[model samples]
Target: MNLLHSALRLASAESPPPNLNGVVSTPDGIVLLGLRGKPLPAAFDMTQDGDWILPSSATTAPTARNSYPAVASIGRLEDGSTVFTDLEADSVLHLVGNRYRAAELLRNIALELGTSVWAEDLELIVVGLDPDLTPLGHHKVETFDDLRPALQRFTDGLDLSVSELDTGQDGAPARRAAGDPSDALVVTVLVVHGVDLYDERLLKDVCERLLARGRTSAVVLTSSTATSLPGPRLSVDEDGILADVEWAGGHVRAEQMPQDLAVSLLDVLATAQAPDEPVPPAAEEHPWAQQMTIDGAWDPELDEPEPAAEPLPSPARTTEQERRLVRVENDDPDLDDDLAEWGDTETPARPLIAVLGEPQVRAPGGPPPIRAAWQIEVVVYLAFHERGVSREKLTTDLWPDNKATSASNVRRTVAELRPWIGKHPTRPDIEFIPSLSTSGDGRYRITGHLLDWELFRRLRKRAQARAAAGHIADARADYLNALRLVRGPILSPLRNRGYAWLNNPDQHHDTLIPGFVIDTAHELVDLSLAEDDIEKARWAAEVGRLVDPDSTHDSPFLDLMRISHAEGDTGAMRQYAELLLAERDFEVGEDLPPESFEVFNRLFPNGLGRAVDDR
Candidate 1:
């Protein structure tokens, strides 16, 4: 017992005792069949009268997402901000705040699980944990009021930890007239059984996500987790029978067993769990710190100061929040003289994304014409951050009010964008310019990143180091090649007009193809809608309403009209929540956030939630 008495006996052990009487029950309030209530489900209780409003239902009911919320707060929403004043429910958030909180909780749980069980499969849910855990403390993370019965009691009942049996056979995997090949060394043995044995730092965080491909091959093993229970759960017949692995664990450990073989060996020794994968763990905290705890609610104290956020009419694809640095051929000449005294180059940092295709609006009339408001806003904000963006958040997102006439229309759109940028023989002394800063002093400064935003920061750091080594199908083929080059839109919207990108400003670089096609249709609807896929949740709500026709009345096309009203039609789910509150005015807009419409009010329950219950 050395290392300082094993670090003072692992700091007097922690966690396990605070189960708060382990309540855990579930299900309540509204969401009858769509399911959601578990923890944070008590927000909306509206009802007006004249102008007939009426929102009342969500007091706490939610039970359908892979089930279990009773207190499930995953948190992370940035796409332009505003989930309770621009996000901040910190549990964790890494790779670009886990791709902006996994594209807003996988598009609100793939439209409240249209294909059920949080569908979207391009994988990458990740979550190993224990980097000295402490966002709230004692493993604290239970804030769900309603989210499908606390995600059906934490994905069918949070076992927490239990798996220890591998009696050592050398090697064993191929078991069939088919996959039958063996060496028999299957050791899992984990037992953090609700964490205790001197609180082994989250069971050594399951050996930091197991994977060993090869290195003096004992198949190169490690992560052993367990306290007991790598058996049981039978019921198999149709020829691939084992009568329950011969009455549950008594013979032929390997041989013709692909079917239930004791529920495929209880899903092969269950105990690798590590779900809530956000992971930022506060690298100086950023994901919006719970939207800065209502930081004066943007402007209520001064009796109203929050009115600014509207820009992007193409002073070259404007809108840049923070993470827009994009550095490549680093010489550090004071960061290349702060990127040429501030033209912000290095091409949006290069990873190789590709989602493009926008440019067909303003047609049905005659007026929308007068352009060149400084050469298409610096040639569409450096071709919408070299074709992929969701950050670097430009001032009021591209010039809201008048950051000095949007920095004099971005220094006169970078003097006709130094003659249309074209060459860069892989960073030939760098060039893809555009960037200025100023979210501080007296405020109002625009411009940022360009090196094709480092192809989504090098395919999200090589698909998160190939999913931390396990390489789940090569991190789902690099998240579908970083979501097909993310088509194009990170600043283009056919003219929000500007002092800085004031919303549309006659869209150049074609609103970066609907902001990289609705951010890769919300990251391919965050992977086939969490893996369920009601036809890819109606083709990711039809490419997020064909590149934003106001998201066909938003909330992912009212979650495809609540999955076509649960496959039937309670009058088309009350006419898709009374057509998103009569022709799309359904609460929360100054850019977006009424909790980003938590799955469109759990599935469209219109009526200005009585003005979000008057706050």
Candidate 2:
């Protein structure tokens, strides 16, 4: 068919479709713009594969505008003079009548549109169908919530198309991992029937964004009104004859073309272009378009979304709770009055317990003597210097051979101990064992007393620090003080009994003593040796060896042997060597360490040493 016939046929085919604004066709892609809930034309390229529809509004009557809300309905520009409002669910005439903030909106649209069009070779096409169509049409996109989801959908379609072209898979990554960013292009076509249908500010803003991107656009406007957008221009006279209208600001040339050019452009660009004579027919339904229903939750009267208010300031801190707890713990004179505000449901104050020596009462004349019982055993076992004792330790230490009864027995023992300690005058008002909330592993602790072992450890650590600082006198004083506090093995009176549950034949019987105590014994031995007190060193080493038969504690027992040799006590040296030998044999099930023999050789120069040399 000739150009005239083709033009006449295209013009005759044009008809007004409700909610269907117009078609936007680039060199390679097409987009359909319209109102929500309208069926698309079957004859048009409804591939849905590359189509994106932005729903303007529901076909409902306009509602009243609400007062200024949390979310700003209108945002000001950098100059603070211009205010932009949402176009979604609002009429173009209404928005234009109020001089809509089209420039700011258009700037955002341009940026988004540029990002959305990701194909390298398609020409940018903008068609104006209605002479008064605004940038938002009937839909609104003001904040991130409104724009991001729709923009993502459009980009997702582009990504899918690029993936299919590169790898023939729906969502597979593009094969060109290192491809230039420009190679993966985005081509967007804005379609409207008439330029006059859009707000003038919006038109100017759209033109500016396009020009900034170095794109020269073509506009179809009446011969009279001049557009600032510098590009190729097509003027249609009242008679519908196409004329090349020149503006002073125009840079790109436009040839005088027929008024039916858009129809021909649509027919050419919207249809599938297959290299072969025929292409396979597209599926009737696609997920992309099927999911494009208008999300109709627009309460027209409401204002734009605002930020949530900050929370009220918290009340000032008070020491009343601490004071109450302290008073209850100290058995104070005003305990009842101080605790009056605390209701029955409120937690009772916990006792301030001490365990530095026999777990006695630190408060003067508060509590009388604490009798020796399983409660004392529980305290010693629970108090591991700074570390918490394990539940297994409590169960085993309390009920050695009876595995089944251990858990229940431990519970009973703790229950009895709680009341017993609470009855003490020092902490009569406080619950000694506050709660059964132990660690994840069911470990327990004594809450009432300050443990002596903890004080001993702190003193020993301080002594070591002093020695390292060259304060020998201070260190010696601290060491003496720490050793004086030992009194006896960690638990003292209870150490001999109540640990039948420590029935580990694999470890020596002496392993019943906590490892921390054994370590403390080793520290004492070292301090004694450093002080050059042979008697004290011997005592400390013996205690360490007795408590740690496995020698796993790695005490300084060898130092004791060396000290014996230095003192010329052959018998004592031999005894220490024998002990060392026995320890090594226990550990490795082998002969004594060579260092033990060295001790013997040193003690008996010409005796065992000569015999070994002869061999």
Candidate 3:
């Protein structure tokens, strides 16, 4: 509460606003503060206890002209959310204020994008009047000194191609648009607080930095009836407050930012992340529907006309478009350079065989056809296409208990499967899955098909090797590709739902599927952490949860611990500890592991702090 109180004191000292937080720019000083807690003015609503910030005269003094004492407090509400006091007041303010609303908005954006924006997409910037008034101290943006380094650190080693902008310059944001901004979402929030403010230049620089971006949403939180910066002025009635927003080109609009505002903001994010497998025809009428497209909204002026579908390419010929789509999304420039040494390598020609999830076969750039049980089983045996299975081995593996009648069943299944693969009505000569070959020993082999699981395995292996060699960017791309192939557990529907009545029952997964998924997830998380990618690490843990919902191991616990530590979220820490206790008891039939205890001890060596008492 100390930081929040300090900010409030500063705000009150400098003609405090009706509510908390605002952007102030004077001839001698410019400060941006987003405060929370309660309304500062009695005329304003008293029900909202949010943080506050103040504006002060510009000066380069070492000590503050006025300083507030620290406030100590802690507790929780009925809903189990913790209440904070002392320096922890900033947390309470943010959790209850518009800052929390902004975070929720970002999450909703991620959901809409079919990608994560957690820590992955955001770039935060906080401009405080007093250096000590850092919000949560999670990752503070230290004015001019911090902007470049912070932005560099966040974007570094990422696929994002940031433009070379002179961030130290007063108004350098315009240059940032030259680089590709799609790699990550950059959101900079400037919070200025303190009585004796100095170096007002950085405050202006931060606003410009955000303005330079082609895509950005800016909102000004203020309780002032008269805003210093010229912009749109909102009229918050007795129960409301002013939110004056001023953008470039004198474009300004103001509005009421009360609890109702949150609902409106949420609608924007929800619309962006609408679940559309393939956007419906009617959806096109909606303004946000264009966002669902792969390349975003279609541009009638710049974009080419919609092209008719071309027939799938044969093994002998490759179209340029087909080649591009067939190749995995490798984001690393360095990896491309490394691969260049091997000459002009093209996407290897291979038919798409999906075995990791439901067993289905589809040609490159073609739709997946429904496959029979035996057809899928045969394809699984010839996973790499180059491999072959002996007729006896196939029977034993397919139906060991029914060995007496296995051969006839296999023969019947193969005969039925041939027409679907060997002779397509459109291309009579093209063999999606070539006729099975009988070796001298009567072993059967299916040629010209590639299994998706095998490809996923190869990609994971390559990523592992690249990571070992310290080619992190290359490794990340490979890991992403590998993970993308995992739609569900290996051989789903058939193994999990479709044909459980078959001789080979499902639910009992192949030992390989679960083990492979868990291992790959761990590797992905580890690699992501090494690259300082908390969001990717978080996503990896989610993938692990999908595969091993019971969390048979400690990876999920460790992941939660790491996430909580990075965010300085004590509640998350408590949740992680409780989960670990339950998980460990179930898995090992013992108390939580030493690692879990170590984290718990660090978070609450003094009996779980006030958080435990609330429970």
Candidate 3 per-residue C-alpha lDDT over 286-388 given as tens digits, one digit per residue, 9 for 90 to 100? 2222212211212222222354377433333255433322222221223333323212234323345665666666433233245556555555555532445
- lDDT of each residue in 1-615, candidate 2, tens digit only: 010110100111111112222222221111223212234423332222322222212112211211101001122122211111212111010111111122222232222232222112222232323112223212311122232343344344344444444543311111221222332332323322223424344455444433343211111111214344443333333332223321122221111223254334334333422234421221112211111111111111222224226421222312433222222223223323322322222423433333322333222223324544555555545543123455576565566655536466667666766654463345455444444563333446555344344334444544544454455676666555655554443333334555453354522223333454555555656666667777876766665555443465434455566567656665665565556555554311012233443434444332211211221
Best by TM-score: 3
Please provide the root mean square deviation of candidate 2 (C-alpha atoms, Å): 35.1
lDDT of 1 at 479: 48
lDDT of each: 0.29, 0.35, 0.39
Candidate 1, residue 585: Cα displacement in angstroms equals: 27
In candidate 3, what residue range of length 10 has the lowest lDDT sum? 64-73
lDDT score of residue 460 within candidate 3: 64
Arranged by TM-score with the best first, the candidates are: 3, 2, 1
Which segments of candidate 3 are over 4 A away from where they belong?
1-350, 363-374, 384-387, 400-408, 423-440, 495-509, 586-615
Off by over 4 Å in 2: 1-372, 381-415, 423-429, 435-445, 487-532, 545-557, 578-590, 594-615
Residue 471, model 3, lDDT: 62
Q: Give TM-scores for every candidate, taking all chains together and pairing residue i with residue i.
A: 0.22, 0.31, 0.37
